[model samples]
Target: MSNPTLDLIRAHGSCRRYRPDDVSNEMIESIVEAGQRASTSSNMQAYSVVAVTDAAKRAELARLCGQQKHIAQAPVFLAWCADLARLDRACQLRELEQSSEHVENFLVAAVDAAIVAQNAALAAQSLGLGICYIGSIRNNPREVIQLLELPRLVFPVTGMTIGWPEKPPRTRPRLGLEAVLHRERYNPNQDEALLAYDREMAATGIYEGRQVEIPGRPGEMEAYGWLEHSARRVAQPMRTFLREVLEEQGFLLK
Candidate 1:
């Protein structure tokens, strides 16, 4: 009961190492065209992608994204933006005032951007290209805004690097469906499923070499598993300045 698309999706893995080949503009446009076909809320299409190919700019962007070498090496770096400025322009053209301050609007735009980027990623993969999503683009939002020349109501949601794969990363395991899927009503009791998945992931040795040490209690755990790694990630404070950055981008959380 599987098809090409489904098989492709299941086989998906992030490509961190890429060959030095370039992704042509024609190929990029075709991929984006596929993205443009993705469903959008109210057909608002509140997203824009900025493709950065300039070596210097890509280097700078890689630096801004915590020195991710893949981003610097990839031939193309796309900045997916939640763009409400175009909608605002539409209102201006109609001589009507547009309000982008609502939190709902912000959410809508972000969701739109993410959906489109996923479509684009699949399209690239279909063409035998590789991609890696870079959420670290939000690390220096203000500088990114300036570098990309994004106007008000436009926020960089994420970035993606696309190129020919030098080597593809191993397929990562996902949690069992029992942990996430529930019929009819919500099920809060999933400890057993979680623990089982933790054991399964531990067996794969995914975090064998790169284990995050739990602060104040280093080397307490003999074998680090998915639970411990994810717990550490969730416990840490991340992107606390996003609210202020969103405000500066003219998106009001209220």
Candidate 2:
């Protein structure tokens, strides 16, 4: 039940283990080429990527992600940056009154960076490489910027650590059709079916220790599930500084 494209994408999960196999410079160049081919916004291509393999740099990066060992161990880690700086410079040279100050331009560039990064991720997966998103790159944005030497108006949007998986994690169950895919306009809520789905998910052990970890949090339900896990995330201040950090990087620079 696998077509070429579907099978390729379905094969992706996350890789936290890797052998000592060193990825050659040629291979890294090819991977970058794969990513560069992704469609862009108005051909502006408002994104940049920095491939980090230096041991010292990787070590610093590990701490940025709360000491995630995979960051240091991965054969390659790519920092995907939303690069509005290049466009800004072009405007400066032309003495153009830059109007790209609104939040929409920043959002569009961020999406452009991500769409291309996903393309590279899928391509790597097809080549028997495993990739995991290191979303914590935003935890301390300026550190990442200084480490990568990103310019003004450019911000690190995300990180992708790639290597061969030492052991595969389960594909992880997704919310069933009725819960997610909606037709026509939209439904703000679907309570009963969602509860049933949550119950089924708990039986699958995905929420095994969730109740004990944050008893007062969202995922503390007797029927543990993904919703509970998501609740705990939003309950915290994890994403609180993103907008502020983006501002510091001159992202909304008018």
Candidate 1 global lDDT? 0.92
Off by over 4 Å in 1: 209-220
Query: What is the lDDT for 22 in model 2?
Result: 74
Q: Model 2: per-residue lDDT, tens digit, 121-185?
A: 88777677778888888888888999999887788889988877777645756667777878996
- Best candidate (score: TM-score): 1
What TM-score, computed on C-alpha atoms, does each candidate reach?
Answer: 0.94, 0.89
Model 1 residue pairs with clashes: none
In terms of TM-score, how similar is model 2 to the real structure? 0.89
Q: What is the lDDT of residue 4 in candidate 1?
A: 99
